[model samples]
Target chain A: MKAAIFEHAGKMVVEDVAKPQIQAPDDVLIKVIRTCVCGSDLWSYKEGDHKQAHSMNDGHEALGIIEEVGEGITDLKVGDFVIAPFTHGCGQCAGCKDGFDGTCDNHPAPTNWGGGYQAQYIRFHYANWALIKVPGKPEDYSEEMMKSLLTLADVMATGYHAAFCARVKKGDKVVVIGDGAVGQSAVIAAKMMGASRIVLMSRHEDRQKLALESGATDIVEERGEEGIAKVREILGGPADAALECVGKQAAFEQAVGVLRSGGRLGYVGVPHEDNLNLWELFSHNIQVAGGSASVTTHVKNVLLDAVLKGEINPGRVFTQTYSLDEIDQAYKDMADRKTIKSYVIVD
Target chain B: MKAAIFEHAGKMVVEDVAKPQIQAPDDVLIKVIRTCVCGSDLWSYKEGDHKQAHSMNDGHEALGIIEEVGEGITDLKVGDFVIAPFTHGCGQCAGCKDGFDGTCDNHPAPTNWGGGYQAQYIRFHYANWALIKVPGKPEDYSEEMMKSLLTLADVMATGYHAAFCARVKKGDKVVVIGDGAVGQSAVIAAKMMGASRIVLMSRHEDRQKLALESGATDIVEERGEEGIAKVREILGGPADAALECVGKQAAFEQAVGVLRSGGRLGYVGVPHEDNLNLWELFSHNIQVAGGSASVTTHVKNVLLDAVLKGEINPGRVFTQTYSLDEIDQAYKDMADRKTIKSYVIVD
Candidate 1:
């Protein structure tokens, strides 16, 4: 099986790797259909440090067809199409029951699916809890629809989690920071959650267009204080809620600055800063929420319906596509900021 | 008139001074019946530096008789018993209307009541909005009850604000990180909100007793990791919500450490650290909230009912009282941690 491996910093190679096998009763084997590059992967790719090098499988998002299932799996069957969340969890744990699968207690060790999804086939643990079965036949959906479904595996679900954490409500003035895929998805999520006004802070025209199409009513292209100033001018004051999709310090600060006193901020960005000025949050009575999303079966199920109904087209975030052999180019284009997100198709 | 003045960093004197006059249309002159030393005041007191000297009247919390009212003040009358919140706001601003007086946009230039409350007479700005009428004659209530009403001016209201910001739901396991007046009040607030279990982190036996009396079901006497360890041992895991009442880094860290994954924290401490590790909060899916409490009339009114009904006794936090002449001793005792809180009676 050809799989993407992190060979060294800034480099990835598709080489023949042993296919995954089901070791647990709840395990299921899936043939990868589609996967993509996430912004977070750039952290290790850009660092180029040996200690940060990851030899394990690369991707955390994938939509695939079930090839085999272990005896413990009662709900899912072979030949079914399913989407896997970035993190896997045992459905029976207290944490999982409470809808925080990211911190599932039963599978205490690293429980992410054994083989990365950017491959010919992958082994998934806790099949029933970790996998969301897509209802329709794979051949019935168009290529764009398929890509949209693939987003439910990570980015779309994560964006929705941000909105959920921020408690985005109807009539809320929402400010979304970042123009990346997740940020675009957040624009769509904020709209879906009935936010009255959506503001996207982006410097790029292309991403800004996508942001508008995704439901942003306004855009603040300026960076830093200028960006905050522009947003304030547009909203007349700070927004009621802010969704921070870029995990950088400046982006977080901007998000905080654009929120009204007592407003809530939901952040899903992988933070690059070690410290946050809590005093700022304290003085303004702001609430900060959102972390590594634990998109439970509930969130996936709701998003799956929205995708099938064509209510949202998150797949537009994938600006380019590549084959398994062109994995290097796929990552390079994403890391170079040439693409919002790049997709990899495998069979 | 005699008033407490911060002459030097560590010294205070009760000397003859001009009585405060009503400067604004909404200003009201009040005969301060009770004023208490706050933990936050210790910041300046302990600094003992010439640069930190504040010659203004030395207290924020006070419950007194309304001696006079400006033309604009319609609701409050002379002889009415009232308590003033530490921060004042014009009731008309968007922030104030929305119940966040701390960030009120109008009348924004250092709107804290002009001269502090540790005096025979104090001038209060935004009198109608900042002062909560205690709804009875001063002579009608007992001294202890009057002291408890004074708590509504700052400590009790702040504690309630923490609980409100943390969204303490019924049956929640709450952890309070400080055992001072505000922390003790948080214990009472959590119980009032129907928290199933309340844990107080305190080293002093007296504070622990007050904590238990105030509604804390458990106490962790150790500090730092050891304190967290003791709490974990008791709870078997993290708590559902945590209240950070102490502003130091260690206290904040301990509060964060004790919250369960996806738990919420409300903090009232004046943060001493410039930075907070958002990474820790993000990884655990924790939500952080709280600010300088802007106790609106609504909150004060509700708390006033609780106090009048004998449902809560926040005044117990004040262990000692001093006359205006002994104001210096009051500050020293509180600064040395000899008393949980000190009160000053001026007539």
Candidate 2:
């Protein structure tokens, strides 16, 4: 099996690795069909000096076909197409039952194969619960549809989680910070959730255009207070909800700043700083919510059907694509902000 | 007019002050009938070195009779009994219309008379909206009802806001941190909102008794991790909602600690510290909300009707009473933790 390995900061390699084997009764092995470079992966790629060089798994998102099913897996079988949630859920824990499988207490540990789904073959523990089976094998979907389906594993669902956490509802005015793939996806989510107006904050023209097409009603190129003022100007007042897709401190503050008093903010950028001011949130009465997305729950409940029905085209976020051999370059493009998201065709 | 004056930290006096006159077209004069010493007032009483001596007006809560109506006041008449929310709101503003009158955009400034509702007579600004009519003069109600009505101005409504912000619902397990009057009031609010299990964290015997009587199903006498442990033991898991009625960082953290993954928390304590860690909240998916209570909205809509119907008894939190001349003692008792809440009778 060939997998992308993190050798150190600013360096990665695609090398032959041991194929993952089913170690648990509920486990299943999947051949990776599609994967992508996430914004979060850049955290270690750019400045992970404290991290052990080459000891961590590289990817969490993947669309795959089951090559082998363990004896305990009753609901799925070999050759079935599937989408794997970034964090596998056992489906029976209290967190899973409550539709927050991202915090599933009984979730199986990451595979001991020394790599992740960015590989040719990966093991999925508790396959019966976490894997969302597509109606057919990977070859049945168009290239565009495949890219969209692959996002259900994490990015699209994560974007949807932002809106869900912020309590975005019909006729709302929303401001989405960070025009990366997740933020663009949030624009689509806000539209699906019936936001009356959507504002995407972006400095890049390409990302801004995609966001507008995806349902952003407006765009602000400014940053900080100027950015907040622009959003308010466009919406005629502070927004009803703010989706913080960038984890930087400035983006977090801007999300808080653009919200109306007694407003709501959902953040999913994966915190790079820890300077939250409770006093500001207290005085403004802003409801703050967001975390790792409940990918499995969102996929099984809402997104899978929406994707199959063509209600959303989240695959448009994949502005660049690469072969599995180009995985290292994929990380570089994503890290340099040259690509909104890098899609890798692993098969 | 006799009013409570803050001379300095640990020093307060009852002195004759110039009577407040209608300085704004929207103001109304009220003869104070009942007021209470709040937990927040003690912040200045114990450690207010930076404050100018004798500069700050003391109280914010009052049940009173309208003494004089300003020229602009139309809905309220002179001699009508009313409850004045601590923060007066203009009825027509966006915040008021949205039912968050505490953040009303057009709220009138504090009266210029240099005194507050702890006085014999006080001014009610934004009279048409923020003042809730009691349907009769103060003489029409008994001492018990009067005490309860006074709470609607701030304490009881604030407690309700905690529950409201936390989204407390039927059959939910709730944890309430703080043993003050507002916290006890929160226990009542949790019950009213249909939380099946209410855990009140209080080491104080008097406050615990009052909270238990007010609808707390269990009491956790411990603090920190132990308090959280006890709450889990009582509820069999982390709580579905947490009401942070004390504004200290420890109280805030405990509120966060007791909540289940994806739980909600509402905080109303005037924050004495500012050390909220967004990382913890983000990871656990805890929705943090709350600020100054929308007192006028709660009093006008839900609480007034509930109080009038005898469906709640929030006045039980008033464990001590004093005449207007004993105002300084009222502060001392509340500050010393010798009283749950101190009630002041005025005319």
Candidate 3:
């Protein structure tokens, strides 16, 4: 198998490697169909040649078809298309039983993800519960549509889980900070969950458009004080709920700033450099912190329904899709914001 | 009229003062029946009080009877008993509309009560909404029971509201930090709301006994490291909900340490200091701060139900009471913790 290998720091090269095989009775071999980059990927991508740790493929979001199933795999068989979360849960940890499958100890990510910018394949443990079978393609899932659903395994599912964990309910006025794919997906999720109005803060044009189309009723371009005030102006005060999607200091501040008394703030964006203000959150009585997206628990059912109802067009987030050979250009196009999201088509 | 005047630092004496009369059309003249000392009252009591704003009478919790009602007051007439919160809302403030009448603009305390201890009567605004009518008191109520109900005007109500706001449900394992009147009240509230297990933390045997009698199934006498470990041992892990009843540093830490992954911590204890570590909260996905107790919104109903059913005896909380002439004794009893709470009979 030809796989993208991180030969050394600051470099990745396409090289011939042994194809991934089912090592356990519960493992399933998935033929990579499509995958995209995650923000976490940028951490290594930024470290660029100075550290060590990358041993296997780097990416976590991928949609593929099962090529072979271990004897223990019962729910899925060869040829069934599936969306796989970055890691699979064994479906027995107390956490996994309660829908937090991502935190389960089963089949922890092998310490050998040498490179994420790869195009090959990987086998999953406890494949039945981890690999969600993508039933017959949604009524009209063209290649582009499938690429969009591909994100459901990571970004979309994350956005949705953030809101769900925060307990956002119908008639809520929600404020979403950051206009990335996850932020855009949150707007759609908030709307689908019956929020009366969704306010998104975005200065990026392409991301802003996606937010609007996904159900954002109000869009503000302010960053800090002005941004919070704008949200207050639009919601008539602070919002009933807020989703923090940008893992930046400014976005987290803005997310907490515009909440009404008793309002909840669901934060999914991982903090990188800033310290959270306990005084602000504690005194103001805000409930904060919802963890990462639980895509494994959601990707399958959500995609099937979206495909059936035509309610959401996940593939529209991809502004460009390239062959495995165009990976570098894909990264650059995405980093520069020239594309809402870039996808890599794998066969 | 004679009043308990806080004329200067460390000085409070009974002095002649003007009688209160109705001002607004909905105002009511209350001949205070019982007023209790609160920890907040000690803010001035400990400061050795130089009359704040050239005024005295620092008490914020009181229960009494209606001596007179303004023309617009229809809910009560002369001789009706009532419970009043410290701050009186005009019943029209946005805070009042949202059931957070604690921040009401007009306030419920007497105008003559600009600062310090007092013995006269009070003038209440929007009497109908500002005053809660106590119902079905036993024919001969114990002075202690009356004082306990008086504390409900503040601490007890605050505690109950905190528990309710945190959404403590049936079968939930609840842990309460702080054995003050508020924390004790929270134990009762969580139990009333159907929590299957309640843990109360307190070093004082008296407070722990109160907790056990009220409803707490377990008591953790340890603090810091030992306290947290004991709590986990009792509940088998973090509790489902933690009612933070002590505002002090140690109490806050204990509260945060004893919650399940998706647990909620309702903080009602007013922090005597502001230092905090929000990252601790954010890391575990703990939902902190259920907002200040909206006691005014539930006081009337709680008083009526508890008194009518005899299911709860809030009055046991008051261990001491004094006449208007001996206000100093009441304060001393509370200061020494010789009394869980003390009430001053003002009539």
RMSD of each: 2.4, 2.4, 4.8
Candidate numbers sorted by DockQ from highest down: 1, 2, 3
Kindly report the TM-score of the first chain in candidate 3.
0.90
lDDT of 2 at A265: 94
Question: B248 in model 3: Cα distance from truth in Å?
Answer: 3.7
TM per candidate comes to 0.95, 0.96, 0.83
- lDDT of model 3, residue A17: 73
lDDT of 2 by residue, B1-347 (tens): 88888889888788898998898888899988788888877888899836668864568888888889999998999889898778766777555676767766554342211137789888877888788899866677789988899899888999999999998999989999988989988999999999999999988898888888889989998999988888888888788899999899999989998876678899999777876787787766778889878887888889999998889999988889999889889999989988889999886
Per-residue lDDT tens digits of candidate 1, residues B242-344?
9999888898899888876678899998887767888788877788988877776435657888989999999999999999889889999988878899988
- Give the alpha carbon lDDT tens digit for every residue of A1-347 in model 2: 88888888888788888888999888999988898888878788889836678754458889888999999999998989899777666788555676766655454342111137788988887788888999976777899999899889888998998999998999999999988888988998999999999999999999989988889989899999999888888888788899999998999999999886678899988887877887777766778888778888888889999999999999988989999889878988988888889999986
Q: How well does chain B match by TM-score in each candidate?
A: 0.95, 0.96, 0.87
TM-score, candidate 2, chain B alone: 0.96
Clashes of each: 1, 0, 28
> B93, model 1: CA deviation in Å?
3.9
How would you encode candidate 1's per-residue C-alpha lDDT over A1-347 as one tens digit per residue? 98888877778888898989998899899988888888877677677534335475458888889999999999899999888777776766545665666556466553333337788888888887778898867888999999899888888888887887899999899999988999999999999999989999887889999988889999888888888889889988878899999899898999988887678899999888867888788777788997877765545657888989999999999999999888889989998889999998886
Summing lDDT over every window of 10 consecutive residues in candidate 1 chain B, give the lowest-scoring window: B106-115
Using lDDT as the measure, which candidate wins?
2
In order of TM-score, best first, we have 2, 1, 3
Give every collision pair in model 1: A276-B276
Best by DockQ: 1
